[model samples]
Target: MEERLPGADRLPVGRRPSEGLRLPAPDRALSSRTGYTRGTWLAVADHLLDSLGPWFTPSGAQVRLPGRGSWSGADCDGLEGYARSFLLAAFRIAATEGDDRLVERYTRGLIAGAAGEWPRLTPCSQQMVEAAAIAVGLHESRAWLWDRLDGPDQQKVVDWLSGFVGSKTWDNNWRLFQVVGEQFLASVGAPYSQDDIDSGLDRIEDWYVGDGWYTDGDGQNFDHYIGWAMHLYPGLWTRMAGTAADERLTVYGDRLRRFLEDAVHLVGADGAPVHQGRSLCYRMAAAAPYWMGMLLDASPLTPGQTRRLCSGMLRHFVDHGVPDERGLLSLGWHHHFLPVTQSYSGPGSPYWASKGFLGLLLPAEHPVWTDREEALPIDEDDQVRAMPAPGFLLQGTRHDGIVRLLNHGSDHAAPGEGEPPADHHYDRLAYSSRTGPELTADRIDNHVALVGPDGTSQRGRIRRIAVDGRRAASWWKVGASRIEVASVVLGRVEVRCVLVDGPGGVTIRHGGYAIADQQRPEATTAGTWAQTVRTDRLTSVVVGLHGYDEAGVRLGLDTNAFGPHSATPYLVRREHPGGPVLLVSAVVLSGDTVWPEALAEAIEVEVDGLRCVIRMAGGPEEAEEVVMDGGGTPAAAGETS
Candidate 1:
């Protein structure tokens, strides 16, 4: 009875051996009769575990910045999540390479890092899955050094980690971490009460969402956190412990596979996943699915594809940027800038990407071994897909799997919208287009509270649904009159809109880039009725938006990256009060292949009309200017006549 480590976790930090460590042959499913190069695994793992990885210190278990800033200590809660990556990597390497030395170094490293009596008495504050991973790693390894440690030392590790199981803050990630850690420790002869483990399991059930998802906290919990920490730990822990009664753990893996299957198609031929959320600080964590694939026999992904996906994902970040100037994972993408991370995200978090090692869990002869790597589905052809993520319609398409993303959601609460806000933002109905690194983070300007999926509703959080089909819908704070660019594939283009009430019925139409007359939409409504609209194939589109900001109102258009195949271009009209209302324009990709712009040419101010008609051709430019139109009802009262 022990926690399971993969074939690569065991290794010393900072230096690499002249020859890489030798890993054992994977079970046939992972490769053919011939074992693959164990050193390849060693090099990759070593590079990750080396001191270049997260820096742990004696004074405090801090994730150090390489150059600037003081070595900040992990808030007690954040400490274990930080160490988990190192320990998981160490244990994983030992499993694969049969390197007992590697396991000993890290096990001792954990004990040394735990240092004094503080850890034994205080569980990590966050109660996150990260620390649980480390606990499980060591419990499983029962590594060379475990027997050598004084009873007090080993007890310190268990007590520190186990203590988290019963804390009140055992909030979301905290309990999740407890479940995995406790499961692992109990498996390895540690005396965590079965009652505690069962209770922890019950608490986790409280947050489970169907389709393989669980929100770490209340509201719409959507992001890599689900993949990396939540379902990830539960799935791995149950597998390691062979816990059959933990239906939630088994279900978590199945659901995770569903999410990965539904999602893997979105990554283009190059393996670039869409980036959305915090600790993107942990860059490659998105690829953690590849490891899960190895852990579960029912995976939809192929081994070669897993290898390609993980390897490609790894190289993408490392090539683009993972470590900043100091050899430590930086705080931001392209540079150091994120000031909003929970203490847990320090440099060490990214290696949780080691979940990638799940790929090593395979038996060597698997087809992932024999099958030639196929180009990812996204890179293979042109298609449209819709998924419910974060919140909104996530439509993805690709040209031979070259990626294209169309974000049809509200941008009401980006960074600066709340205390920590988001790490990325763009002003006008932001939607990220990606060919390489994570792009959604680029949009960080919504000025409202950006809580989870249920954050918007009266429930005061984002609404979510669990597998039992129990429904929950919290109207997360949303940008009124919000708009998003959905998909731009090859020569075809499409943008979607979900309009809430706004100044003058949330008008949108095109002007400068308008094509000659063709069938155009008369209106867009939340009602089931699809307004009168048509589409004309054009090489470019000009979608404009006009809404009110806190300051009176603002006018803008989603028309900057102007091209049929490029990210949709949107520009806001700069407005000053005064002047007879002029013209407004909008661009639409009507159901048909043909498209034509509808223009509103009226120039009068109607004081109380909540609904403003966007007359076809020459209609007023749908003003993005926020005018308190008609009792907050954007339909009648304050329409400009």
Candidate 2:
């Protein structure tokens, strides 16, 4: 017998029941790759909305779903439930050309909340954030909801949103929330500051680093916010403003088009987006920009490619058990792992993923829905591409179907901010679609540090020297000393060469990818090489090619988001007299079987002072040489034979 929600029977017919929710049958003819048609998206939207029935408060003022509250308290969390979900409901109702049920349900909440059941939006308050979603919802569904409301109710709603007229937001992507909220107000003939809207849109120009990348703020704070919030809101604001956004639309559209060119390669063949940055709990929100690109007709991807990419990402999360059995989006990746969430993440925060459903705004007959799915970049061949603006070297292997990002820049710290503790998400030397950094342990992965009496050095505020071809170079400081690193990638392997200019008697430690599983991973070490293999055969390997001694594995319990038990392979050089010493190693993460000895034997390294040459047999590159100049910065010396 299938367990059904109170309104499950009223859901559309042809609904294919899953564990706790019902979705439509796959349309394999149109979406052969992901089998997720427009009907599938509609079913998901309706299922999620229907699942929220029991959580609505009396008078429909707030939904107030279960789970812990954020720093903003219960009132704000309740508002989040109503506002965020309203965004999804709005997309659904608008795209369907009007769904009376959804409109009426959210309309009651809007009216009651405007009548004072909800908290007033204050300066920089969390309510201010929810106000943007509410404003956008009202604008998108104006005909069915806002226009149908009585005059007094409409003014009450405007009164609540007028809180943004003089309120300030954080300098980061929060600025765009004001732009979106105020623009919607202007569209509806309410009190709005054009200055707030224009300034908020103009402020992002300062953070744009070209090549379609923008740091979240003044710092090197590049992350998912660049897409989900930064690009998503401005594009949405343009839609609400219609022809009023003509000039800015041209600029924003070009920027988004260029951004999709790079972002398209970031997802793995299996549809997982690179897991780097904050707010990862928003899961599929990474797909928001791709949809926006389609909405604005600014995408480099074909309609087939856009649908494939977007549907692939949406399916990846669904396959991983997002919206758990109870059909709730928990504050974690894949499952309920809290460490991946931020302090600001309330239970309803995950609903921000409603941004991904923006595709629903397009009608079923749209090309993005009707087009046949196409292959992703990773699905066809291996790739090695460099994005200099963000200082990332993207490597994708067709065989393993995994994509790795070698991070040479984009540390979530301001320049000259001094050395702070390493952020597991943003400060790692590498991140991938298939692996996550060990977030709750002393032993970190994808990192190289000089360990001394003070502690292991952090890769604070990366100073990027170069990012070209398959190689990237950056340097960081440990007190008075400097550590420079250059990485050359070939297939699934990354050969990292490090030069340290510091005191003596310190231990240099380097860790490989962290592989996690429900059970303890099989760990092995032999003669300067180490590897950990999960039961499903995903492997993380590290080998010391030069300036290192012993190899080992570190076990971590409940320290990873992928699973409960995790293992990291590490190599160490003891009693190092750190001045001008160069260390070289090869690290790998793949789904293929990796023999440690064969990997170590395939790579040869030669070090002379601060200059190092690395050669890999049967690798993509023939040979590469890296040298450190007098300033202690690594530079690639081009390909060598």
Candidate 3:
């Protein structure tokens, strides 16, 4: 008995009562873990498409969904609604052989849009972004939608799409839009610039730093875009080009295979993607590359593992009330937490998650659908992996089903003078599957800064020094002061060491993970340790192992995507006698109860001049030692348990 948007009952085609998404019953036989079958995917697609019935304009050229418009304004937002949803509808129609109602609905929109109902595409405009989605939809549903259009309407469509020819785009992933759109034009015998397409493809080569990693554009800008946009578009472009793409296909495929090898370790046992990076409002779109892997047969993961990973991701959001009661994807994470969205995130922007539905393109008999679900890396045992390309250290614990990312690189900073201020999403020292960085005033979660008269120093432009096994190191500047940080991850804890080379009397602050929930989290500070525990028993703890003199918790309201109430544990060194001072802290986030004093007791720290050594005692295993020099460079003497 969900409420429908205006004009829902007036639709002439596949309209149904608005009861939210009507998913199929769990098919445990096929999907033993997530219970999401191909039928489940189809049902969700139809439900999403049908829910849009009330939003379309009379001419069907635009879909004006109810929500705040993006900075691009309402005109671009309307086109976004139509084009993004059209992509979803196209996926459904193509997979089902032909959904007559869907084909007709989107076809009408296309014709009306081609007849000038939609806005003209312009250089570096949001319209150019939607044009790529429209081009892909038309290419995928050519037989039913594109081919059936009258010759005049087809010409009009070509004229509209031709805007991509010789047009400039932002140097990032937007380049791929022109590549795909012009390639689609070429497929239809329309005018296209091979140079435009080739240049876009070639531009990404400059950003690819091997190990299957691409920097989005430049300057260590790594995030989910690496999966959803960077890899997804090239794979789809190759599919659209067919035999002509064979050479590039092999190259892109190899890179994708290597990327997936590292990506498989990023997801938690509960299927949550590590909450890092920007544009996170596109929730499950992180799975697009995994689906692309299956599409191009370019993945090292087995069919069972691939399905498990994708299904787990989709179900993770669905279970968390992603679509809400209205069956609409909002510009937020689990709920309407706007901090997770960017200025370009309109109501329909989340539908770019449609790319995740790429799996539906495979035949029903494909092993990805038929194979039984398998466990992810986190479901088996604890894992610690280093991705040097992005300078990330991934640590996953099997007991708690949590995955933590110790980020030594990927700050989203451009390479030049006057870099933009540090963003909470990219500048945090750590991110995890279960916790989000605090975004409220005086943000402190997973950060280290020197509090000065001007303000807290920003961790500007991370310069990575090393990312080796179980350890990573990086250095950044706080005005004239130089700050070096190294992390050694073990089990559920990360030993963070910092070296400060600044003037004296300024306080140094270090923060732990931010835990959030519906209710105010339980927080405590005693002696040299601080802790915050959510209602669900998710815990965050920080202990002052050295240099820090005080510990406390920072409270936030509506500043996190995971919940409305959040708390972060932090330690502060008061009146630091700072020139080249060394500080050490143990940071932990887990589902189990942790005693900060006991944890501090278990970890023994010894410092002689600038060189520091840390030995962490394991319950049943031997102690692990990490040695660090003056610059906070860590060399582990033993393996992580």
Candidate 4:
């Protein structure tokens, strides 16, 4: 039976529900004054499940999502895809409180798949991820399915899931896959290696980089996976292990609490989560960490605030046509855009978004449902926070409620790989809650590139030096060229300075925001000083305040993962004269009116480059010299209220 504390209904709504947040209420039992209820989300989930009927194979072994291409990583796409989606469907169905015929049908399909009755459902090393999902799903619905199954069927399920016991998993987040699978095995009194469980848990701890962040692996692989998979698993593992692992549960609780503190700040006021990292296609899975925190009681957020963040994020995608007219989740950020997916991502991969519905596991009477919805940190005020582990300085704007991440850290490119190629997903100089990375392979946005003699620019892996308050610095290699850059950001303005030490005199191409432009853009240029391109929903403008020899609006061809085409207004300085070159540019992105008053600030630099001053909307004397390194603690300066 689920436990609940009375008087939860008396809890105040932390803040008025935002303007566009048409989210479902926490649950059904807790009567919402609005017509909205958790049933709305259930309907979406059911529709998603029903949409898969067209893709299921004869034996239900594989479910190819309605998409064109297949990933090369797996020999069989349908098997992994079907298993993963089924795991989600089964888990949700098991936790749901209602009489739904679809649930029974899905449960039967999962049983057949798990029992290996589907000859096409072959086991492989990559299947370890799916295997864990299946095991966890069975555990989550143990009373409804696992316990009801006959001895032979239960053995079949156990025998099939046992494939992960001694399997070879990837070194990174894949470690958690093994750990969760083993935890499930242990829960059922089945054969599981305690050594495997202990070692997997210990190894995952190595990925933890403090300040509520994990590297995903040894190199710079930080992304949503930290919240969706890395953190989500520990909570699930704790619940699966129960009292037997109380000591480890305490450790996980503390770590998860710390992580949520940072994670909550990443969401934008518009309900969009930070649009960095890979698997941009797993649209709503970004909410998994918050939901997991709720599940484990390890979060710092109030119950209402947790529901608000999770529900708001889900509604954000839903409002954007995530489930197309046919009710199918596509392989892209919002609608269908193929570039958003990695090679390992298959059609069924998006089903991982079901992890967002983890709150369904909580009983309806729980305070999370009874309490009033609260505002996110970004919603409450404009703020800036520096997360050292990820090498990011987070900036949240009060007017727009958009959270921008100044990334001095995180690149998908592995470390020590002689010369690693840059994946624009993680290498971008900045990412926001509203915009996406410019996906053009060569000419990337939100980046500083060293242009060769042939005009083709090269991007190198950037190693972070420090981030203090609104200031951040990093070093990157462009071919044989080595460049260091420092940025002092306030609102939309980022004053940047680049120091070059290389073999040849190179051109520095500082690209700004990659604003999505489906319609014709109203473009304006002011010689080499500034350029502004405005679409209906987005406006990208870049002003060269200093050191830029030329500035122009560059169009990226099918270069954005979020949208089809993007326009980047970049400032270029040629014939670098080889030494330290300072380029200060103001990049502004807004759906609202672009105010000149906010952009009028100027950056002043001294001869030695020792001190940089930001003259705010006020005057020169009000000019405050920003510490380039922020004295090593950037966020300590607190929000510029």
lDDT of 1: 0.42
**Tens digits of per-residue lDDT for model 3, 1-641:** 22222223432233333356667777778788788888877877887888888999988888888887799888788889999999889889888789899888888888888788878878999989999999999988888888888889899999999999999999999999999999999999999999999999999999999999999997779999999989999999998999989999999999999999999988887678999999888888888899899999999998889998988888777767656657788888877667788888898898898988889888889999999988887888989999999999999999888999999998897776444576888999999999988885576899898887877877877877789988898877777787888898878889888888878878888999999887899999997799999876899999999888999999998898887889999999888785788889999999999999899999888866666777778732544444444444432222110
Q: How well is each residue in 417-492 modelled by candidate 1, as lDDT tens digits?
A: 2312433321122232231111232221121212233332111122211111111111122343221121222123
Quick one: ranking by TM-score, best first? 2, 3, 4, 1
- Ten contiguous residues with the weakest lDDT in model 3: 632-641
**lDDT score, candidate 3, position 100:** 94
Model 1 backbone overlap count: 135
Worst 10 residues of 2 by lDDT: 632-641
Lowest summed lDDT across 10 adjacent residues in model 4 is found at 2-11
Off by over 4 Å in 3: 1-18, 619-641
lDDT of each: 0.42, 0.85, 0.85, 0.69
User: Residue 252: error of model 2 in Å?
Assistant: 0.6
Instruction: Write down the RMSD of candidate 4 (Cα, Å).
Output: 7.3
Model 1: how far is 440 from its true place, Å? Answer: 14
- The TM-score of candidate 4 is 0.88
Q: Candidate 4 on 1-641: residue-level lDDT in tens? A: 22121112322223122222223443433332222245555656766777777777765666766565454343345666666666667656665643256446556666677666533223345567777777777778777766777787777777877777776677888888888888888888899888888888899887788877878877777789989888888788888888977998888888889999988888886568889988888878888888788888899999888877776787677656666656667788766778878877777777788777777787767777668777677766768787888888888877777788888888766655654665767777888887787666666478888777666564565567777766778776655556666766666556666656566577778877777645445555664544444454466667666667877776666666545566777778877776455556667666667643246344444423534555655433555564333223222121110
